[model samples]
Target: MINSKIRFVTALALAASATAVYSHGDVAPQEVDTEGLKELPKDEWLSENPYRGNKEAIEIGASAYNQNCARCHGLEAMSGGIAPDLRELTKFDDEYFVNKVRNGVQRNGMTYMPGFEDVMGQEAIWAIRSYIDKRHYEYKDKDLAELYEQAE
Candidate 1:
């Protein structure tokens, strides 16, 4: 009887653990509302982020990033070893950043990241980049509060 009970408990534990491990992957991607951002040409994808230092975009991007990216990228663009630290991407040009986000990373028949191009538009992507730029500045020991001032 005790052996059967132990087996039942072990099965329950495994089931719970599996749920925890796979829950994040099952989450549906949330839509970001880029209402106030300037509309970009739908056909022509800009190589550089036009909203790089825009304050409004940064605010919207923060919310968007938390909703869409925080699960894997960690809170505030920090990585918990699950994904690449987005702050490090600040060193690369905007073109490289956009391309990665648009195309995503895959290796050996495994998808490390999914492309957001279909779900997220250019404004949303650039806004997220702006927020990451802010996080990068903060990560580098720069004053967070003065980031916009410096940009100006």
Candidate 2:
């Protein structure tokens, strides 16, 4: 019994160590590749984001949001149940929000929310993001340039 317990502990330790291991030859940290820009924590996502303050994109996002996410995330990005308020997604970066939407069920989505990557294209996700940002933060065409400058 003691031998088995020791082996179990050893295996668990090894697995954790292996997962944490990173190398430049393997996978280095991800950086923004847009316009020869380097990514800061706050503004990195805005690098490739054409939807940051695009009105048409927000409208499309609203359509997608209403069609798919309104049930749980609420209409206009508000939330009342198991899901978090999507209006808050504006507060998060592109990668974090994208992963959550794509990994819907796995990341606390119930039967109501579905991973939308298949049905919606990348533009749709950005649209949703744009809408959420404007609605939640009162963003506008003029404020967008400065939005990228603000720190978290």
Candidate 3:
């Protein structure tokens, strides 16, 4: 009787442990609406970012990125070990960005990312790219030595 009771307790503990681990599953992607942004040509793909440096687009992009990408991509696109630092995408053309986001990426048997084409419009994705680009440029342009010297 004691052996049977021990087995039941062990099974219950294992089940609870599994439930806790499963709770940390993938985060759901947030939805973003690209209203108020200029629409791109439907049949044609842009080779370069048209919204680069656009004030309104940058603002919208910041918000959209925080909601949809901040978790994996890191806050301000700096990356937190789970994904690449988006600030390094300074010279990537618009087509590359679009294709990656639309199709996502996988390696071996693991899914690195999930495609957003079905849920997010092109404008929204482009805006996020723009925001990332802006952050990269700003960080690159900063005179770190000067700022450090000023602190003293």
Q: Going through the candidates in order, what is the number of backbone clashes in each?
A: 0, 0, 0
Off by over 4 Å in 3: 1-26, 142-152
Q: Write candidate 2's Cα lDDT for 1-152 as tens digits.
A: 99999999999999988765631122211121122122224323332456566556666767766666665676677677658876555554677777666555553544445566555555666666767777667423346545544422
Report the lDDT tens digits of candidate 3 across residue range 33-64: 67778998776667777777666677888998
Candidate 1 TM-score over all chains jointly: 0.85
Model 1 spans with C-alpha error above 4 angstroms? 5-9, 22-26, 149-152
Query: What are the per-residue Cα lDDT tens digits for candidate 1 across 1-152?
Result: 99999999999999999998887774566789999899999998999778877799999999989988999999999999999999987635789988988888899999988888988999999899999989998889877666676332
Model 2, C-alpha of 117: deviation from truth (Å): 1.2
**Which model, 1 or 3, shows the larger TM-score?**
1
TM-score per prediction, in order, is 0.85, 0.54, 0.72
Best of the two (1, 2) by lDDT: 1
Q: Enumerate residue pairs that collide in model 1.
A: none
Q: What is the C-alpha lDDT of each candidate?
A: 0.86, 0.58, 0.77
In Å, residue 75's CA in model 1 sits off its true spot by: 1.2
List pairs with backbone clashes in candidate 3.
none
